[model samples]
Target: MRKIEFVSCHRLPERSFFFRGKQFPFCARCTGIYVGYAIFIPALWFIKIDIYWALLAILPTTIDGLTQAYFNRESNNFLRFTTGILAGYGLAGLSDFIAYWIVHFFKYLFVN
Candidate 1:
């Protein structure tokens, strides 16, 4: 049997969550990101999230990740998870905002 792993994440055991003695497929940060996606994507259709807010949402994760990578700063699972959630939510919102504007522009050009 082939072992499946999430390619995007290192999936370090120390950074991951365990349930029932089995480690979760994704690390804590990734888990939070997916959870954020689950919670935010559905709301996109109803909420009309703004571009500024979306960009703002992503800042924390960017800073956290960068600091960890370049400055040798260490982050805990809780911090990673929280920042991941913000990043995921921001990404989804930003993508939706861009897509909406593109479609609207095309529709306007073709229809009017």
Candidate 2:
């Protein structure tokens, strides 16, 4: 595995959660992100939205992460997972924003 993949081992095991008999690929927060991306990317077309909606989604995760780092506070796996979901929701919005711009750029190039 790459160094990046191995870095998960460095996280606080007290913060890690397990399922069945095996360890998840990542901790709860990362799992939430994965689940969120899976859900939100496809949801863009069904929902009417702008980038700010995504920013709202990201606020919890950012605050959690920053508070943990800056204040040395401890948070639970559930909060991490929920906040990760928020971040993932925003990530999807960011993707949609990028796609919108890309499509318009191509339109500008070919039609103009």
Candidate 3:
């Protein structure tokens, strides 16, 4: 019975929210990205704001992964996952204000 349940659940669709165990809307990196964004965005908004610094911090992950990917040396899951998380967090922090502005702009442009 347990084996049947595990097999059935494992074969379920990724987008479906009907599985067991940990529940995340997206995968691991996505979860990290969203959570990181929520924590860092507000802190950066109220504290010291430096987009350049954030970019600098995130550049290593970007360049390393991209170059490796381009060269077809992308067998390192750990490296890719780490880089993706860092880049996602950095983008979220740097773009929070821009995201808000865009949403507000769209709201006014589309509504009425």
- TM per candidate comes to 0.89, 0.85, 0.48
Task: Judging by TM-score against the true structure, name the best candidate.
Answer: 1
Q: Worst ten-residue run, lDDT, model 2?
A: 2-11
Instruction: Please list the residue runs of candidate 1 whose C-alpha ends up more than 4 Å from where it truly belongs after superposition.
Output: 1-6
Note the residue pairs that clash in candidate 1.
none
Clashes of 1: 0
What are the lDDT scores of the predictions, listed in order? Answer: 0.89, 0.83, 0.57
lDDT of 3 at 50: 59
Looking at model 1, residue 59 earns an lDDT score of 93
How many angstroms is residue 58 displaced in model 1 relative to the true structure, after the best TM-score fit? Answer: 0.7
As a whole number from 0 to 100, the lDDT of residue 6 in candidate 3 is: 27
lDDT of 2 by residue, 58-97 (tens): 9999999899989999889999999988898898898889
lDDT for each residue of candidate 1 in 1-108, tens digit (9 for 90 to 100): 556653688889999988999888888888888888988999898887789999999899889889989999989999989988998899889999999999999999
CA RMSD of each candidate after superposition: 1.7, 2.8, 8.5
